[model samples]
Target: MRVSVVICTCGRASILPDTLDTLTVQTQPAHEVIIVATQPSDIPDLTRYTAKMPLRVEFAEKGLPKQRNHALNILSDQCDIVFFIDDDYMPSADALEQLSRAFAALRYAAGMNGTLLADGIHSRGIDASDARSMLRNRPAVGPVPIAIKRNLVGLYGCNMAYRTDAISDTRFDEALPLYGWQEDVDFASRVNGEMVQVNTVSGVHCGTKLGRESSGEMLGYSQVANPIYLSGKGHIPPVFLLKLTMKNILANHLKQLCPEDWIDRAGRARGNRAALKDWIRGRVSPDRLTHVRPSPSGPKP
Candidate 1:
């Protein structure tokens, strides 16, 4: 039952210590803590925690998925599961324990699981702003767990777990330009297993802290390109996919209204441009995309 915790971070040094503190208190302390960091100077004083517990920190000189792939690839053979945590998130004390329990239950049941992200939180001004996360805010009355034996629309990588065996050849696709979409879901579906949605446990996702460019935030352009790629792969139904693409375009346009800065405005414009171009091309020049390569083995986690 050894689990390897991978945290992919780039330059968010201040908040990382807090996340590490939370990790130390997990009911099931991870066998190894691997930091796939990009910014070299941001590495913390390891002696503080390492003297008391097992911890290993490493760096990657690439984007999110590439770093994740590198980190996942280097995990020792003894690791039975891989737990992914984004840099900006802090898990509850029982997060790792809950994930281990969920995976154990999945193995016993001969199935897989889909993770539920804490899309909203009362602390730190976190709240769900879109329909995609409308269901994450209910009171945690009890440990409500449910079985969903279907293809997940997507996997929330911020707080997701994967079995070593199930993900034998799985890795996040580094080729995808934006980290915003499709890749995780693509990999999960190709893994060919049952995925359940677990609501019994949750974590705290501190949204967009310190204005860092997490894959989740950047590549907003993926909001448009992703649907096209998915549709080309025939993984997503056309009508629904069309609706989602349109919605993302509208959302990006709306976001353009409240540009945090010039860079944000530029990003929004790029996203909106991608959306409009794809949509218009879908109608007037459907065959114009004959040269774009289809996704290979689909999206990577």
Candidate 2:
């Protein structure tokens, strides 16, 4: 099958080199490479990398839907399948081939989830050499040496593949959430498909410390708010949303163990206040109550 690998990157040129190298060496090389460089100049050095590579390069304008949606809209017709891998990830040589094989083997499955290998370190930069070291032993999460499958809640956006036809029919929702959050979950929820976790391709998901957003950015807020929005639409329940938000907050705090940066005491307090306020004012969005009823056709796709 002709597969196009889609990578959406924003201002991370340094990491692309390793990502490109891995792609170039894929056992099942992608038919084409379409990069949605969110920033026009984010990859000025693209020519240098594409010079000796067989893959063709393409760019997309950056926006809220992010590069994945941009690439899908433009390239879906050109490729049979579209595989997305993060700029920071290094794919196994056979990752592409395996993902395709999994889909072929499981005709009913719409999407397959690939495993992630986080280094657990926050600050150090990742490179090709580091990827090789991590790959030598094929860590537990490193490579899906065998093919196993199961129904899944969703696929991790960074390392997943989908038939082009699936996405061509309905592009990812741009208005769902932003700042690297929930696009995958929300997309899977809306798309009519059976999700699967597949034991196919696996590779080191490199870690980074310095360049990522610090605490000041309301990443936590978006994580919380997006679920709230989804719940209001009846995609999820309020209690479940609260549980997830609190769990996410606690997990981050546990990882950092820094109260000032991790403890969201005020957020907890404000959450209660907001709930109380909504209850008192009867100002819940219509979606939270009346709109949740199934459509005439039944449950939404």
Candidate 3:
């Protein structure tokens, strides 16, 4: 299979190079690496990597879904599988190789999400050096385990792959705007076949907090509004949406008491309230995030 890697990023120039460096050592090299950035400066100098791999950089309007759709529009015709990975993720050396094998075996799968050896998104965040160390020292494992769970709702956006043909008629929903919290779920649920999870195709999500363009308010609004929007669209069950909505709102409130230095819990809380109000007034929409103004005083410190 001819595999292409797509990375849609913005304001992550500082750490994106580390992710690119790992790709250089992949056991199964990608046919091409397409990077969609909002501006030239959003990506670091790539001249150094031009010789190591087939790399292409393109500019797009800011917004994760929009940037990803831009990549889909320009994908190489020869590409059979397109892997979407975050700018902060680091795949193991054989990840692509294993992913290809899994896809070959599961002929009916439309998409697949790789196992994450270490994910720092839930916590403070992980250092690139530390993430690299974890990847390097991970214990030798058994055969790759691939499963096609009928109930799988979505692929993890940090590291996921899809057959090129499966998405020939699909595009990431631009309605979800920047960060696009549940865009992956919305996309996967709309595609043609089953989604799988493969253990052998693993990676580390450093979840670097820098270069994030979404404010806590915007993210919080997305946390509530996107799920509701998707559920209403019939992409996700209403029960799942309700569970997700309450979980996020409850977490934000509980965390506000002793907020992490890196997180703006107060801003998120305020945004949550705003979204609830909008919902009650029948004005809730993910697009409203584009109109959300930043807090003048910034998030409570």
Candidate 4:
């Protein structure tokens, strides 16, 4: 099956090099590499990426959903399978091949997310050498068919693939804008075919800390607002959304009590409170988060 890898980047030039470097080593090279940047300036320098694979760069407005949607539209009638991966991730040598094979075998599955091999998504000091070493001792991933249950949400926008023909009318909902928290769940929910999580299709999410990170306020607000919005639309169960909402709220509050360097507890807590307040006032949605202006030196949009 012909496979195309889609990446939507928001100017993470620092980590993008490592990401592209790792892709060159894939056992089965991608048929095409489509990059959607928020603006022309956001596109990374391709001079370093000398591979012969066809590379396509396009521009989109400033939002994850919009950027991803733009790329999908461009490749509407192309490729058998489209795999989406984050800019800060490094795929194993066999990751693309494994995904292709899984799609060939799981004929009934419409979309799928890959198993995340262990690696620091935010680890500092990682270079091309470090990424090469990490792929050395990959754990054996067994063949497992994806099954559907009400709570079984499978397709993650990051590290997920879908048969080009199977995702008929489904598009990433632009309503869930910006960093697009829970955008994956919202889009996957609308898909008519079964979504699965596969073991063979796996990669390392090199969560690099040197790039633009989501502000606590943005994340916190989305945590409260996105789920509630999705639930109201029947994409998520209220109880499940409640679990997700409360869990983050409690975690932020707990961390506030026992401050951690790694977590922005107070900021996220503020976002959660803001969302709840907005919800009560009859204004709750992903757009609310977009309207919020970031503090100077805060998370970039």
Best by TM-score: 3
lDDT of each: 0.60, 0.61, 0.86, 0.75
Among all candidates shown, the one with the greatest lDDT: 3
> Which stretches of candidate 1 lie above 4 Å from their native place?
108-151, 178-180, 214-218, 234-241, 255-270, 278-301
TM-score of each: 0.74, 0.76, 0.95, 0.89
In Å, residue 268's CA in model 1 sits off its true spot by 1.5
* lDDT tens digits, residue span 156-198, model 4: 6668788989876678889987778888877777877788877
Residue pairs in collision within model 4: 121-206, 121-207, 121-208, 122-207
Q: How many collisions between residues are there in candidate 3?
A: 0
Write model 3 residue lDDT over 3-93, tens digit each, in one string: 9999989988999999999999989999999999999889898988899999999999998999999999998466989999999999998
Error of 4 at 169 (Å): 2.2
Model 2 clashing residue pairs (backbone): 122-209, 123-209
Q: lDDT tens string, model 2, 1-301?
A: 8778877776677767778887777778787887777556566476655754555445655543556777776774887778877777788777788777777777777777766554423334465687767665664533323335555555677777887777657666565433445667667666667777765567777754423433222344455555656666564446756787678656544644443332343443333334334546755321222122222331101
Higher-scoring candidate on TM-score, 3 or 4: 3
Candidate 1 lDDT tens digits, 139-208: 4534534454444555667776777787777666555542425566655555546655675446667564
Q: Residue 184 error for model 2, in Å? A: 0.7
Greater TM-score among 1 and 3 belongs to 3
Model 2: lDDT to the true structure:
0.61
Measure candidate 2: CA RMSD: 8.7
Candidate 4 has an lDDT of 0.75
